[model samples]
Target: MSGTRRLFAELAILGGLILVLAALGPFGSYATPLGPRLLHWALYLVTGYAFFRPVIAAGSALARQMGMSRLVAIAVACVLGAFPTNVIFVFAAAGPAWRSVTASDLAGAYLQTLIVGATVTIVQLLAERGAVPASPAPPTPALPDPQPAAAADATEQEVAPALLDQLPPHLRGPILCLENEDHYVRVHTLHGSALVLIRMRDAVAQLEGQGERVHRSWWVARRAVAGAVRQDRNWKLRLIDGREVPVARASVADLRVLGWLGDAPPAA
Candidate 1:
């Protein structure tokens, strides 16, 4: 589904569930029928509006960094959110109803929520897989032929040394790029990671020849990508050291072209 349509659907579901809970509230005696209905509707609007900002912000950030469709993330979040929300309603009504909320009730509610979430997740995964296009194999770069012994000796070589030496000894190893809350780039390398007082773009430029930007906040060594997994409608690129990077839709094509998504043996 499109992002906007999915968002509207989530809002509708949230509203509907809130209404259902309010109507079924603690023997229906904790509030007048009208009062519960009005309260649910009002809370839906107010809380929904309040949560929308952070939800959108987080979704966008994840989408950019992880490469999953924002719509899928939002839908999953909404489905998972229903249970806690219903529990909140139960707790809120407990005091007024003079009845304690029981473990059984909470357990039952959580089980139901899990079932619903799993169902939604499975359906979305199937839909996304069906929508994936069968793509052509990517082209491999050509290698040059070796020179003869005589020519090799005559050739004046001004070979560039490894860039790894430029960095401190401790900072040399597999690197993970992270975007900080303050919008700065944090580089985690094998020797040790550090938060550079620089923008992500600048960091990327500096690390240009060393690694590729696999995600918005991730610049990984080309050799680091160990495998790929289809999670719901999204793809995650797994690194050799167990780091997982989200593959964005915009980058999917490029990744494929770079042979990142090709049929290859899975990492051990």
Candidate 2:
């Protein structure tokens, strides 16, 4: 899914939580009128999302470019973002007078928003991760792996993935795999490789049953695999073009489950 659709899906998930929270009425809000309490929680939660998410997402992207952990960046952004978001929440909690907000009260409110922000961030991240299955183009009748003689027929019938359209005409042939290089992902096609100014995750998400990420920085098309190479406890996918893409140990079981590893042998 594109970012906008993903955002809507995430907000819909949040909407469900909002309904439950409003019904339960936490934080001593049970005494308030149901209508006002629902509105208050919605404003507080949604505004907090608007405030923290952009900064956190940007910080995570910058961190990746800077060769830093996104978790560290998210922690920093969530903590720092809490201050301003808390201001909005404090003002929204109109029962407490502005003048009555003591330094200790401000501190407590800050702490509360920080915790809530972190929780919401975790939920949103999980939502995006869970949304992967919703991507990929609609399923079509599976075809046999391409062969040299059938290449022309396959090309004529195959609906090109949107991602390949970004490549140059000459390089828009069979996709082998993707390799990440800092800010860009190098698209390895059967014709030749070229760098595309798109993130590896986004590129993989755009693929329509052509490939999947078998490693943190690599995505491989199953049909392009020549064989698997074992290096002691490590594993690598040897492609038809003689390129070896490292396979993450964690992804080994998934590959085995999908029949990428012939007969579901042990990962190691």
Candidate 3:
């Protein structure tokens, strides 16, 4: 489901749970016997669940990115989140009763909550780990020999108009290609650029079929690169009208494959 729909659904569920809990009888009845205490615990659990769910999810995602096993990450995140979760429960419940909560009670509750949250997180992570395959290392490509100066200039001139022709008419001018925080790509056209909301890996795949990634943040039409300049160890691709792009180490192979570094004529 869309994030908005999922958020609304969670909110609806929380509202329902709150209404049900609030309708339950006086605290004095529930406080006396073990059964009443258990009910209060249940209430605390339900109330705390909503607040910690997102925290756990975020932790899991971070762990996954760091190459930790799903199980381990989730467990760590959930466990860490539990203390705060239960504390929230205490603060939330305290207002209605005006009872002074003792330090020891809060500390014990925090520890208990941490244990429970950690246990739940570990179990969930394990379940998730079992469902996914092991990740593979990304493949590396071989680099090409540098192009000779005279020939490279000629190649640049030849590439520009050809690349421009291939682009949709509307995107032919003032295009700004930027990396979206390493996650996705933003294609800026003459008017404006919108976040494409696509994974960088997927964007690379698609662009590889159409052009070449000349820089970490830039993809160029096989025909769009007007020329290139080497300054120290870095190289920059020159586009029509003196536009320049920095070549990323990761993109060098693809740039070579598209013959972007090959010798070409200068634009007249």
Candidate 4:
């Protein structure tokens, strides 16, 4: 599906789920009338869609910088993002009720939002991870005359097998990085990315000496690394193609040992 259409579909599904779930009275203890309760939940959904989208984007970027997985990033982002969203909800809906609420009540409200955030994150994660890769294109018809043995030999010698060999031919290019999405691995290249059903270890093995795993769920090509940047206390490798790969804390020494990082990296 197109990115735009997919986004709309996801929003529709999320809205439907929230409405149905709200009917079950997840916020039953709030002590509001039926009309007020319905409006409250409806407003909650609006705030959810508005706030969570940017939070998710920022979280994904932060996760990439922190050498974290997509799932981990979403979970962390939602939990942390609840604090701000809850404040917005109080201002928009509770008003005077919010003013009277104690510190403990505010904390409790954030905790509730955190639970809802986690639930929503899990649903979105499942939808993304369960998606299938597109099928490969059919081969073109062969020419009437067969290729000469010399020509075939030269073609074979020119294209050496690398980790990208597992990807579709269209996606083959200079390796940028690899991302683990649930059970599948996304092989990213200068051209684009493609998903393959392979374990991270096996995929890395196929790369031979070409690339190194920067995190448990991320691998990057040494040649593709253009520079390194430190974000607060974390490190990220900027690729030649403009993509960034996070460097795990445990792997800092490894990068230095591998010459990807100098002996004296600026303290993060």
Candidate 5:
């Protein structure tokens, strides 16, 4: 399914689940009126999903680059995210009187929300992992060659790879990078970015060594690196379009091999 359609479907499922949960009124929420109870759970579930989904996705990607296991990454992400999410939830739940909120209240709420968040994140991850089949043979499409760009006015333009073809025609300019966002792979070109429901590994393979995997969730084309930036101990490639793509610490040696960086001391 297309990325947008798949997202809608997932939201629909979550919506239905919320309705069921609200009706059942788990915990002491049963005492609240139906209308308020429904609203409360909807706010809780929807907000949790929207907030933590990206954190878990990005955290997992970073953790993989750090050589941590996926489950360990998810656990760390949930633990770290729980505090901020709980704070927001409490403030929203307690509105105008937010100042009355106490540390104990936050502690109690954090534990409860952490369980729910961890459960939801894990289930979603497992579902995604199971949905992905073993990688099939890479598709063969005529990827644009670097040589053709010198003669920009050539009548016979090289076709973009199968991955790039998935983008809308207008956004099919030279690909600057690819980013793994949740279950979708975002294809970024100078024109713009659009997400496709493809695995990051599969997407990188389709590039056929034309691009470099600078991070677990990011792949960058050679021509796209306009410069490099060193931020403290971390590094990133400044893309031609002015976006910074992170360089995984684990992949630093590989980047050195590519000569993207030179002997520069990290910030003191």
Candidate 6:
């Protein structure tokens, strides 16, 4: 499935699970009435998911930097995320009463929320690890007649293979862009995206002469830069495959130097 569809499906599953947990009254009784209690639990689940998802993503980046496997990084991130998520819940669920609560009471509440947070984390890990396979690539049109031997050899020599050599077999192809998220660099191509354990500076270096730095956290292949778009005073690049990459103010000169910022689109 597409990224947007997959996200919606995940949200639906999470919402259903939360609703079931609320109906079961797993905690037995709350100080508030049934209505408020249910709402409180729902809020706890939604807020926890919202806050920790990005935290875990950042953790994944750090883990990559540390040379850890993606799964291990995710596990560590989830464990670390539980503490902060529980703290948020304590105040959210307690509201006005939290100020009067003792340290011991707060600790107890945190412990309880931690268990729920851990459970949700494990569910997410499982879902990610067991992701469905990508669909087959679409058919391409037939190529034209082969070029002369010398010309073909020269074309092959011009295609530098340094970055492609580092990528896994499936991810190898013409690169489209690189997005830095925490400690990991997300490499995008016509085929798909893969997260590599490389800092933004390092990734940009590997693409030298092939791509240009467009943002502090982004690099785009010159060949893949289809056009530019303007949003308010800011600018973004439109990639060949339709991904919109943000262009930093400092890098505006670079794009202009390449003639990419000519006739900027109207702000939306």
lDDT to native, each model:
0.51, 0.69, 0.51, 0.66, 0.69, 0.65
Off by over 4 Å in 3: 1-35, 93-99, 119-268
| Cα lDDT of model 1 by residue, 86-129, tens digit | 56645664657636678787765554444444433444333433
Summed over model 6, clashes come to 0
Cα lDDT of candidate 2 equals 0.69
lDDT of 2 by residue, 1-268 (tens): 5778778877887787778878998877789999998997787778778887776566656554444556677778788888999987786674657767667777877876887688678877776555432222222222235456347325523544566666766566666788775556777776676667787778877665766688777788767776677889777777767777778888988877776766332221
lDDT of 3 by residue, 1-268 (tens): 3446545555565555444444553334343455655556556646555545665567646543453443466556676677668777776667766368777767867865675455444433334334321112122111123355345434533544443343444344333243433333555432333444466556556444335655445665443456677778666777543457678666666666656665662222
TM-score of each prediction: 0.38, 0.49, 0.35, 0.68, 0.56, 0.51
Worst 10 residues of 4 by lDDT: 135-144
Clashing pairs in 5: none
Question: Comparing candidate 3 with candidate 4, which one achieves the higher TM-score?
Answer: 4
**Which stretch of 10 consecutive residues in model 2 shows the poorest summed lDDT?**
133-142
Q: Tell me which residue pairs clash in candidate 2.
A: none
Q: Runs in model 5 with CA error above 4 Å?
A: 1-22, 31-160, 262-268
Model 2 regions more than 4 Å off: 132-268
TM-score preference between candidates 5 and 6, better one: 5
Model 2, residue 168: distance off in Å is 18
User: Which scores better on TM-score, 1 or 4?
Assistant: 4
Tell me which of candidates 1 and 6 scores higher on TM-score.
6
Q: Is 2 or 5 the stronger prediction by TM-score?
A: 5
Per model, how many backbone clashes are there?
4, 0, 11, 0, 0, 0
Q: Local error of candidate 6 at 116, Å? A: 5.1
Instruction: For residues 53-161, write the lDDT of model 5, one tens digit per residue.
Output: 7756767675646645556777788888777778888889998999999998898788767865775676566555444321222222223344453243121124336
